[model samples]
Target: MRCEDGHDDAAYVLGALSPAERAAYERHLATCSFCREAVADLSRVPDMLDRLEADEFARWLDPDHAVEPERPRKPQGRVKTFSVRLLSTAASIVLILVLGGGVFAWWWMGQQAPAEPVFGPAVAMSSIESTSPIAATIQLAGSESGTKVRMQCEYSVTAEPYNFKLIAYGPDGEKEQLGSWLARPGAEFSMDGGTRFTQGALARFELVRLDNTKMLVLDVK
Candidate 1:
């Protein structure tokens, strides 16, 4: 009993209409029961189309889809006209799903990937010598951006937490605050740091307490 005259349920379902067309169609829906029911029936189309992954969906949208050959055109009819509108809507849907899938894939990869590459090896920094009651080891690796540093440290003398900084001293009197962390007693912890100076330029690294006392010295030069 509702009007299906000029309203398109598929277009509404696939979000293919222009803004003005959409607003007009929505206004028409308020007075039409048939279009409303049709819209609800087609609402699941989008969810079905989204199952295609980015790569597969992009292949389907590629111009090579026409690589086979073209067929002779037939005379237009009412059914064909409606089908053409549906095909346009389907293209819009494919574009949206392809773009959405690509972005989702990119974001998912960034989440799963490491922020930086694995540094070389852990050097026994405790063997270097210490001026305080701390046990520590250092890892130094070269990177295009800078020198990457990793440390395993423990304040074995007490069970209290103490803040420490990885202070890097360079050959040209360059002092860089590479990184800092809180060292809890008894249990060992790992920390990370970086410096613009390469391993060769780095003269030494010091674990300095908050009051500027050097607890350990790791000579790289």
Candidate 2:
């Protein structure tokens, strides 16, 4: 019903339509928007053909006419026509199913997956004195149910002056990265909001302070 499907209708009027589809299309084109557009697009074909044919005829009759007919380049075929049509239809079906499946899977996962905890350490963190000159302890707490496990580090800066980072390791051998904010000079400094946990029965969080030390561990059971 759109103006874009211009084809065969023009070819039909020019008697170039395949015998199998000509009558059916001509009858349909009498009132169809698609057919109308197709005919309109093809209208120029006849005029062009007529001009070339007439010029050729004239030149043939009189050497003085001397005009060469410009032969239009024929369109090249890629895949066979039937194969292209079949492929197009199959591709459409696949595209629809893929999009539909993705939407359905997303909704299903959202509904079935348990919510993640906000902040918590899966295990206990031990401060490293030998590794770095920094003396710090990391503690963590997280919501039991939400979207992800959050890690909170409550640590102090020693006289040696140090910076640290907290790292969390998931059970699947994937390490979830929380951030290391600088411990404020006066009071305990804490950082939260680590990674999103999606669709696993259980996950663990471990915090490693820069100076590469494990300060605290919280387990989301």
Candidate 3:
């Protein structure tokens, strides 16, 4: 995604980075929560694409399935017209490249041992146990200075908004609030954080509501 800091994390997540670039980005990932979250957000895209077959994706270039153009309307001035086709061959090729070429690599991944995750080691997340209506998963990817935490939550019931904080407790009873958000119902909530405590050092993570209610808790696993 887009960051005001001009970080092109999309490119990073898409495997477009050179070796040196990848190393630098991983170093930056150790500290930048924005970039870390961007990585998590894009991590699933490749897996979704992994479901498409080469033959199926090739259908995008099938001329027979081309979308018929809408009725042409007279323009008042010298307006430009655009093609109505879903995708041209050249555009389709570029689309495949931008999708990280993972669709084509599906066969390769299965023929051998499992390959690396598209978004590196930080992509896989663990589930948080809770009896509440809220369900969520969390991941703690360690960094030299600390660990990058990613949380994905699903919530929906009413149109109301809920406010909450992600609290991290250190081994010695130290506490830290990673971040907070006003979550609106009918949507998923994603957040990122970095802490000095590695995954092993943290006692647990508590999703505490503004009213001092513990909505969810994730113990070390």
Q: Give RMSD to native, each candidate.
A: 19.0, 24.4, 14.7
Write down the lDDT of every candidate, Cα atoms only. 0.66, 0.46, 0.62
Using all chains and alpha carbons, the TM-scores for the candidates as numbered come to: 0.46, 0.32, 0.42
Question: How well does model 3 score by local distance difference test?
Answer: 0.62
Alpha-carbon error at 133 in model 2, in Å? Answer: 10
Candidate with maximal TM-score: 1
List the candidate numbers ranked by lDDT, top first: 1, 3, 2
Q: Which pairs, if any, clash in model 1?
A: none
Report the lDDT tens digits of candidate 3 across residue range 123-183.
2223344334466777777765556677888766664688877787778778766777787
Runs in model 3 lying further than 4 Å from the true structure: 1-131
lDDT score, residue 160, model 2? 34
Task: For candidate 1, write residues 14-75 as lDDT tens digits.
Answer: 67789998999998765443455457645754665545444455466674643534478887
Root mean square deviation (Cα) for candidate 3:
14.7
Give the per-residue lDDT digits (tens) of candidate 2, residues 9-110: 544655667776787776665434335534553454344333333444355336697675567857547654555455444433333244335653464467
User: Mind sharing the TM-score for model 2?
Assistant: 0.32
